[model samples]
Target: MSPALHRRLPLLATAAVLVGLYASGGLLYDGFLSGRVALNLLADNAALGLTAVGLTLVIFSGGIDLSVGAVVGFTSIFTATLVERHGVHPALAAAAALAVGGALGAGMGALIHWFRQPPFLITLAGMFLMRGGAYWISTESVGLTHPLYNRLAAYELPLGGRLGLPVTSLVLLAALALGGIIAHYTRFGRNLLALGGSESSALLMGVPLAGTRIAVYALSSLAATVAGLVLALYTGSGNPTFGLGLELDAIAVVVIGGTLLRGGRGHLLGTLLGLLVFGVIQTALTFDGRLSAQWGRIIVGALLLAFILVQRLLHERLGRRRDPIHTV
Candidate 1:
């Protein structure tokens, strides 16, 4: 393949996966077309889709955010506790959640840039710290009698008949569009790509390395806050442990979306497709009836591992030998 076409290989592969999964829905089971399928996917996978968008940006900057899941976990409590205790306006509460997430991300980015620490370690430490804080804030399960949360999350737009869509899906899509616009048309987006492609080169070229880097992490944290907010609303409660494994799920979608873990390569559109593909995997597996819930994790792990190996091979063949990349 020509170099230009080669860059599209992962996208083509992801499209194939999507087509195959959609076509196999018939073979998967009778309920494939049911409202249950759509609703479960919406409730369970939509937040992860939002989470994946930010990870796409962070990964494009050649850094992994191990703290996103924890941020979500913590934000669930923060949003809930604030609304319940302080009677804050819904919009203001939402903004506060995003600000908190962004601040945490910016702090980590500053640490990484100034102290020259690896993102993995920095984010890992952040993950533990956030989780501990969540526990400290609310050592017990907090339910969604919070009036503000109940209104936003429980509000439903009726589609027709007995079917209705949750407000959360709309929120997720809006955020996705916002992310796409920023990524495709903004200077910060260009700076991020440059940074990902070559940190030293970006610095040498004077790309506002610190500010943009900080912004990228802030965006990621902001995303996590959105997910946590919607999720808290949907579930009618907040728990420090609700989305224990969502960070991995978000990373998986971002990777499957064709974002090279090594930085400098990513796609917002691909992330959407990847989210649908993963949603189907879980829904289809559940529809099949013979598989246990744990099977979802096992199959996802295997799929992610296989994808990593394929990406590694692609990198080896097409990427420079000395320039390493993660099979994100």
Candidate 2:
């Protein structure tokens, strides 16, 4: 395969898997192929989709963020407390949450870049700190009764014949579009891939190592905060425990989307497809109505493992194909 084709294989595989899953679901379940069902998948996993977009950026830069779920939970409680208790405008409260999330990510990134600390360790510490902060703000779920939130929760765009797209889904799509553009069309994105491929090479090629690292984390955290806001709108409440284990889900989405866990290659569109696949599985399970909810996690775990193995094999094959001795 040509170099370009090699780069595209994972994405192609992801799309194929997603399509196959949808086709199987449609065949197995009555009325499972409707527009409403499709729309609901996006609506239900909007937050996960958005967070995965951000995580895609980090992974592209050869970094991992274990704190995404905690940041999301913290933002929910933080924004809710500001709006409900302090009587702050909802918009302002959201801004505050975004700022805090960005700051937290930047701090973690700085530690990773400057101190040469492990990304996993720094982000793990960050996860604890943010989760603690959420509990500090409020151990219980805080109900959001603000008019803005209520309006947003009720907002939907009709698609004819009892089908509609929620505003949250639109937000997820917009985020995906923006992330796609950044990852594919911009210099920063190119540098991110380069950094992921090899940090020394990227630095030698003039990639701003420190700045890019910080920016990547900041963007991830900002996306996490936005996801939290969407979750708050969806649930009409803020719980410190919101988004529990979502970081793992977001990582799984990225991996299933064909992004290399080691980084340097992937597509935002693939992540979107991965999210759809997850949603389709969940919907299928729901339609069955007999399996326990834990089955969803079990299936996802198996899929994640399969994708990881595929990625490892692909990487090894590509490496060998590029080796002059092997080619000869």
Candidate 3:
């Protein structure tokens, strides 16, 4: 296989799994192949998709952000508290949430880069801090009864013939498109890829390491905040505990989407397919009355493990090929 095709093997595998899962669901469940079902898949996984999109960028730079899920939780609760208790407009509250998320991300990035700290440790601290902040804001779920919230929640764009796209789903698709463009067409994206591929090489090539590192984390946080906003609107409430353990799910989707866990390779579109694969499995389990939530998690865990093994094999094989004589 050509190098390009070889690199895309994981992405192709992800797409294949998605199609196979959906086909199996259609065969096993009534009305599973309908347009409505297809749209519902997007709607249900919108927040997750958004999170995965941001996480994909981070992974592309060979970094991880454990704080993503906590940031989502924090943003949801913080926005809710502002709107419901402080009589703040939902829009303004959301802006505040986004700003806070960005700041948190930047801070973590600074620590990781300037202090030469491990991304994992820094982001883990961020995770704890954000989660605690959410609890501080409110220990319970905050319900949104605002008129604007209700209107936005009910609004859906008509897609022909009884098909419609929810606002959250639309945002997700738009974000995905923007992310793709940024990843492929911009200097920052190139720097990010180079940084992930080899930080020393990137530095030698004169890439703006500090700015790129900080910006990627901040961008990831912004995405998490957006996911929180979407989740708040989708659920009609913002729970302080929302998105608990979701960072792992987002990471899993990014990895399953073919982005190397070690950094330096991946596509945003692949993450979308991985998200769909996850949604399909969960939805299918729900369709099966006999199956439990534990089974859904177990299946996803198994798939994630399988993909990790594949990635490891490919990484080693490709590494040797690239450095035939020096590789030992």
Instruction: State the lDDT of candidate 2 residue by residue for 57-133, as single tens digits.
Output: 99999999999999889999999999999999999999999899999999999999999999999999999999999
Report lDDT (CA) for all predictions: 0.82, 0.91, 0.91
Report the candidate with higher TM-score, 2 versus 3: 3
Give the CA lDDT, 0 to 100, for residue 326 in model 3: 39
- Ranking by lDDT, best first? 2, 3, 1
Off by over 4 Å in 2: 323-328
lDDT of 1 at 87: 75
Compared with the true structure, the alpha-carbon lDDT of candidate 1 equals 0.82
- The deviation in Å at residue 49 for candidate 3 is 1.0
Strongest candidate by TM-score: 3
TM-score of every model?
A: 0.91, 0.97, 0.98
Ranking by TM-score: 3, 2, 1
Residue-level lDDT of model 1, residues 1-328, one tens digit each, is: 6876677778778888888887788666776877756666766776798788888888889998988888888988877777777776767877888888889999999998888899999989988988888888897777767566667666777878777677888878788898888887898888898999899999998899999888898889888888888788778877898668788999998888777899987778888878888998988887777888888888778778877787777767776634555322
